[model samples]
Target: MEALEAPPSLAPDNRSVIFTLSIHGREAECSVLREALEQHFWVQPGAGDARILKAFADGRKRITAVAERKLRAHSDEQIVLTSADFEVRT
Candidate 1:
């Protein structure tokens, strides 16, 4: 799985859009895109089973509160949004 995942949307400029793509080539055919994804990296969160592994696995990490808003779909593959819906995160 990717360390970070972002849905494509118009960038902060409101004219340009950034896309998140997965590598599709072998070690030789992929270089440019690989470097681009590496340059924008996000650390993975530690999510372990709460019974035992959770405490021991990442006991040192702080758990942040996450507020979730249900995502609605406009189509089978598209999302419904207005100009106010665009959000870019690190």
Candidate 2:
């Protein structure tokens, strides 16, 4: 995340703020999510992958929570979530 300041040549009152957000590499995780989506929804493959990828791109908190839950369930041995973990029972 970065913010750029207005140039000095610009009038103070007319100045506008600029913000830039950059997301670093997560290729492996994205691949895993893609595979999971393909396996879970064969009829609509790649559909849910976009939503999950967008969640990652937007830095949603739910993704972190899911990871934390997975870690806790594994007693810190590993962090992993299978298709079942993503299913809603109800």
Best by TM-score: 2
Candidate 2 — which residues are off by over 4 angstroms? Answer: 1-32, 37-55
Clash count list over all predictions:
0, 0
Per-residue lDDT tens digits for candidate 1, residues 5-53, read: 3433334443222333222221111011112222222212332223222
In model 1, how large is the Cα lDDT of residue 17? 29
Return the top candidate by lDDT: 2
TM-score of 1: 0.21
Residue range 1-90, candidate 2, lDDT tens digits: 111122112113312111121223211121124343344434144344345444343433443445445544554243444456566788
| Model 1 lDDT on a 0 to 1 scale | 0.23
Q: What is the lDDT of residue 73 in candidate 1?
A: 19
Looking at candidate 1, the ten consecutive residues that score lowest on lDDT are: 61-70
What shift in Å separates residue 63 of candidate 1 from its native position after superposition? 37
